[model samples]
Target: MTTPQDLLIIAMDVTSSRDIGQGDLSLALAGAELVDLIEAGALTLDDDRIVPGAAWTLDDALLSEAVSSLVRQEPYESVEDWLWRRGRDLFAAYRAAVEAQTPVAAGRRRWNPLRGGPAERADSPARRRAEDRWSKGDPVLVGLAAAVGIEHPDGEGAAPADEAVGTVLDAVHDAETELEAVRQRRSIENAAFDNIWRAP
Candidate 1:
């Protein structure tokens, strides 16, 4: 009497029962992990995984429980798609913040005494390029901050004077509550799928 369709219904009932007994929301991860295991099959989606897109399938509709588990994990390639997407890495954020604290100029980096250096000798392309690169270091860092969404959170608001890089990082750091919610959701989904996949 255990047809494939019936099997899905059974799994749902079983997981629901476990969920009720545990009483702790964190315990929901077991159920989610079950579904993940099943969907992952022989390959995983983590960095160690060599074969990409192994879990890109619709096998969970047949599972009696956690149909949404399969559906959720399928679209997690980019940071924005991750259930708990964090800010870009720390080095990136920090550099952005520092850059925001400073300012610089563009164009051929000529050695101007105003920049705490002696005047460049005329016709020296090497010195000119070197000066330009050195003077633009802070600008480059500021650009990094901009790339990391720094204009709004690490240290201050996205304003004319605020250090956008640090402000962005700060904002992201302050989002602990939001991050927790994403983690909890992912945990629960993973729990639902764990049992479906296993070691060889």
Candidate 2:
């Protein structure tokens, strides 16, 4: 399975005390896509900017679309910019794709560990592979998961050996932090509004 797919599965499979925010997952998913593209030789990172590589075919439809979405012109998009632009509602897209691939019963909602429901996917090879990677603490997967607030089972994961991959991971963390700040600001504003309304 691809990195983004594995990451999505991991997010869905998470049994964390709190639900992973959709915004956080979307940013992490974008970062996973970039990491996979770099591995596939579809792109490279020049500092923080993405430099698209030679034309290539990706077997995965979503990944192929990601390639198509790359900024081919010079001064290509920075990893941080790409994460925000491509990550918009990315969680919903991946969730729909996974649900499409995995069949569900007529009336039952798929079990999500975070949501506490019945299991959705059967014991498939893809899932087993993702689980194996998570269990072994694959650096890239661990990094992306951590950005979205999912800690490794054995604490923090080691940094990836690949410099480019590490760059992408760092971008994901920065973007997630920025998003969280925005959330906090909105929360504070809403609370102030509520206090004003409740004042004597």
Candidate 3:
């Protein structure tokens, strides 16, 4: 099965009309990777920190590598930091995977002004279905679309889309907020300790 991150790349390719901005797409891909890890039970978000979870036995190579990297890092890492460092590479990986499966005719490389370089855009029945699944409220798709700023309706009637979007926005906001607080507290604590060390 194609992972949520893969599907998201396809959706963006089809919907962006060859004008996908690299910055936001990278951010979305990075966020999707984290979401994928969380779903696989390999990692969990505790406020601003990403905590290692149970061993992941998944066969997905990319996700497995991500989990390994996370585990090898210090006890915890901030979500924003991870995303900033890894988003572009993850987005590139997704783009490569899509092009490998899709024919050159259906998925074409063209100049993307937003990217300031060549970019791939894919159009196929599978891509269409990916979008449809998102609109129908496949939870992963919905969350990913929301995370990446894609406009996919929840389709559960009037309130569902709003609620679903709200949920994702809240999660991202809360994570960033908590991580910032942690950084601030640590900075203060380190400064006080530094004073003690200097006193001697």
Candidate 4:
């Protein structure tokens, strides 16, 4: 039986085919349930499940939706040439990588407000108040906290104005494209392998 702990979720919602809309993917942490989702066809595995010779196929939009629901992470998508050169099985690695990006960095400064942007912590004692968690006494601690905040731009918190979710999904989509292509090519290869392995 598949358990939630064994699998992960890639939740994403892109408005259209052109843009990389914001999304989250947190379901994969519990691999077993995730595997169950995949087995039941409720959630499609990025490249691995999307490929030929697999149990099912997911369209681009649906793929985006799958990417938006769970914890969001930067998926491991290799360049087209790179994937072809590596002879990887599918986009499973990339999808898994991206899905895994979260929790791994959960407590890190990466999730702080103003991700990848300037710090609200450094602007004197008053300014840092609204931004930092380590703002209790100790001038050195405050300074250190400010430094940390400035370095890790927590996009959602730093600039809530920007469409951060969409940006995340777009990245997922881009990675999936290469995985999808590789999947198709692998289909051809798989057929050959099957024919050879099961030869009369």
Candidate 5:
């Protein structure tokens, strides 16, 4: 499975006190897609700008779409610009894509006293691969997961070896931090508005 798909699966499987924000997840997913594209030689980073390589035919439909959406003109998009533009509602897109691929049960099951209901997700190779990567502390995966608030048990993983991938990861972290700041400002503004209305 693709990194974006694996990330979405992990986010869904995780249980955290603070809910994962879709905006943060979307930015991270965009970063993951860029990392995979760089690994595949589909694109390269000229400084912080993304430079598209020769036309590529990706096997994954969503990835192919990502390639198609690249800003091919001169002075290509910066990593931060790409994150905000392409990442818009990206979490919902990945969620829908994953849900469409998952199999649905046709028959209803009888209630059981001892055993729990069917598992949320069937045991699958994709999930196994994701879990393995997560457990092994794959740097890129770990970095992307952390951007979305998924902490590693043994602390943060090492930084990515590739400079370009590291650039993307850094952009993801900055974007997530900026999003969080926006949330805090909104929360404070909302609280102020409530206090004003409640004042005698």
Candidate 6:
């Protein structure tokens, strides 16, 4: 089954023309993965950092790896730090999951001189499912779409402003803000976080 992280990545492809940066997309997928874990009862927020719970033993290898890395980190990084640290790998994993649905070129689009057009990632059917779910107010999809600044899926022309979705979006925003704050604190700190945040 396509996970929430897969849907979020696919949504980025459907909604944005410009490439979503690695860091940005990674963080977003991290947030989505976190929410997915929570929904599955595998993880929870303890002081705003993800902590593994009953569902930590996920069948999905990518999520299992993410949880395992979170478990091994020191000083108990906040959701933002965890996401920032794990962004690339999480994004890559989710990208693979999404691409597995409809195989496509790796990374983003490229100019194909012979075809005289851009090489594109395959359009994922999972994205359509997510969009349909979002229109029906699937909180996970709504929350993720909101986090990525996509248009509300409801077609009523407004993203959910409800407290639950608000809370999820807030967590995502907090992660991003925390990363930015760390970036501004010092160059070495930024470099350090960048280097060691991701799981090996």
lDDT tens string, model 5, 1-200? Answer: 89998887776565433557678788999999999999999999999999999887899988999999999998999999999999998888887775555432245342221233322665567777887888898898888888877787866779989999999999999999999999999999999999999999
lDDT of 1 by residue, 88-155 (tens): 22223322322232222344343221233322124333333433432344332222222222221233
lDDT per residue as tens, model 3, 86-120: 66556666666655554345456643325443345
Clash count per candidate:
40, 2, 0, 46, 0, 3
- TM-scores of the candidates in the order shown: 0.18, 0.90, 0.60, 0.22, 0.88, 0.63
Q: What lDDT tens digits, residue by residue, belong to model 6 across residues 1-200?
A: 44455455445445542334445556777777666666677766666656666434678777777667766344556766656676765655665676566555578564222223334656666656665676576655655555554545453244444443345557776766565557567887867888897849
Candidate number with greatest lDDT: 2
* Residues 1-200 of candidate 4: C-alpha lDDT, one tens digit per residue: 01111111111111112222111112111222232234445444344322112234334332433333333333533222222322232234434443343232233332211133211111233223322432232222222122112122322223212232223223333444544567679999999999999998
**TM-score of candidate 5 against the unseen true structure:** 0.88
* lDDT by candidate, in order shown: 0.29, 0.84, 0.57, 0.29, 0.82, 0.58
Winner on TM-score (3 vs 5): 5
Model 1 misplaced stretches (Cα beyond 4 Å): 1-86, 92-174, 198-200
* RMSD score of candidate 3 (Å): 10.1
Ranking by TM-score: 2, 5, 6, 3, 4, 1
Every model: Cα RMSD to truth:
24.5, 2.2, 10.1, 20.0, 5.0, 8.8
For candidate 4, the TM-score is 0.22
Candidate 6 colliding pairs, count: 3
Error of 4 at 96 (Å): 15
Error of 6 at 127 (Å): 4.3
Q: In model 5, which range of ten residues has the least summed lDDT?
A: 110-119
TM-score of 3: 0.60
lDDT of 5 at 155: 65
